[model samples]
Target: WYSTNLHWLDALRHVALNVTSVVTTTGFALGDYSLWGNFSLMLFFYLGFVGGCSGSTAGGIKIFRFQVAYILLKASLNQLIHPRAVIKQKYNGHRLDEDIVRSILTFSFFFAITICVMALLLSLLGVDWMTALTGAAGTVSGVGPGLGEVIGPSGNYATLPDAAKWILAGGMLLGRLEIITVLVLCMPAFWRH
Candidate 1:
């Protein structure tokens, strides 16, 4: 699924068309999940994290990368406990190299860390923890909006403090461009030999 394959994209598009029909009911309808209490809130959080597939307009960490990371980490752990055993990590029927596995894990970890740090910074700027955290995650993940009373779809970013707005704007840029693309451009090392 990580390949730049057209047929795979077509298959994904077909599935998306089907799922959109079931999950999305009416446009611009933001249900008041708070009425259902904490259960709805938790469910919404989980779904947001599960996210869309790679190459789609949808957000969150892509499925294929998750599969690759999982395989690599598990195999790595197994090797630690059983050095004599041989373990190979595979994705989409292709074996993954150590470098690719390392890169994916690095990206994923830094992505999560960035969200958390941004959220904490926003909170320091006077926003509540949940509002800042989910807002940071939602924007950084390109999932749009987030849970809680503020910055949710039911709410607007217009009222936020200027600093917070700028932070969220940066988060959107980071998400859309993907972290690696942004970091590479910013790095002094990237400019050198």
Candidate 2:
């Protein structure tokens, strides 16, 4: 891809910097390619979810969730191969209980659903579909720079309406709080304490 639009070294630098920033949830971009089709831009949106390690500043669903999902999938495949086999999922030397698996699944579901909902809201605010989707992903993952000309790495958020900014800010908070934490706070029982 770089061979088409940039010098080899420049492309390497941009790609490396972009990957590192997105993975770490910093979202700094050295270049902006709004002309890239959705197929390519969508990857960045999803990449926002592939955040860094547990203790790092990264803000997507986090690599931990992906690990659990992979383990669960492997366990399912193993079960398919041996219907009567007993299988347990483990991560980082810790045995994963059923509840933890369920929680991870639930969190992933909500994360995806919330991204869609946020995108919808942004579109209603007049943001284009591409911008809305990428913006929602970036904000929800706390990745910061979306795709597209207005919100891309080179684009700034200043052009967006105040309502859209507010929406993004709220989305960022949801991502930063891990969704579950904020949801738990919303529970009536939590307030009773």
Candidate 2 lDDT, tens digit per residue, 117-175?
99999999999998898889899888988887888888878999999999989889999
TM-score of each: 0.78, 0.90
Best by TM-score: 2
Off by over 4 Å in 2: 33-40
Q: Give the least accurate 10-residue stretch of model 2, judged by summed lDDT.
A: 31-40
RMSD to truth, every model: 9.1, 1.9
CA lDDT scores, all candidates in order: 0.70, 0.84
lDDT of predicted model 2: 0.84
Highest lDDT: give the candidate number: 2
Can you give the lDDT of residue 156 in candidate 2? 79
- lDDT at residue 4 of model 1 (Cα atoms): 25
List, residue by residue over 1-193, the lDDT tens digit for candidate 1. Answer: 2232347766466335433421231113234343445765576665555556777656666666777877877988999999999777777788888788778788888788889889988999999888898888877776665767776647767777999989988987887687888989999999999
